[model samples]
Target: MGAEEVLTVISNVGIWRLLKAVGRSRQRLGLDAQRRRLVRSIVAHEERRRVDSEAHP
Candidate 1:
């Protein structure tokens, strides 16, 4: 399977829960900026990939 398919499977397996866990860990470690940046980067990258895939396909 492709990277996109793998990502979809991860999402199906409660990625939000995983994100929340990360957020909690970040809070505990006082890494708010790092966590926010990580989340933003992930979102932007995913959006770009989705748009590119749609445009190409």
Candidate 2:
């Protein structure tokens, strides 16, 4: 695979669960705020990429 396929596998495995694990671990380590911002940024960037790809294709 491709990047998209890899991302698809990640999503299929449950993105929320993965994010929650990251968030929880970060919170435990005292990085709650930064973790939340990171997750939001990642989500926003992914959304934009998806939209752009769909629009162009």
Q: What is the lDDT for 5 in model 1? A: 96
lDDT of 2 by residue, 1-57 (tens): 999999999897797777778788775666767788899999999999999999999
RMSD of each: 13.9, 13.8
- Per-model TM values vs. the true structure: 0.48, 0.48
Off by over 4 Å in 2: 1-30
Pairs that clash in candidate 1: none
In model 1, what lDDT does residue 37 have? 88
Per-residue lDDT tens digits of candidate 1, residues 1-57?
A: 999999898887787777777687776566778788899999999999999999999
In candidate 1, where is summed lDDT lowest over 10 consecutive residues? 25-34
What's the lDDT for residue 26 in model 1? 70
TM-score of 2: 0.48
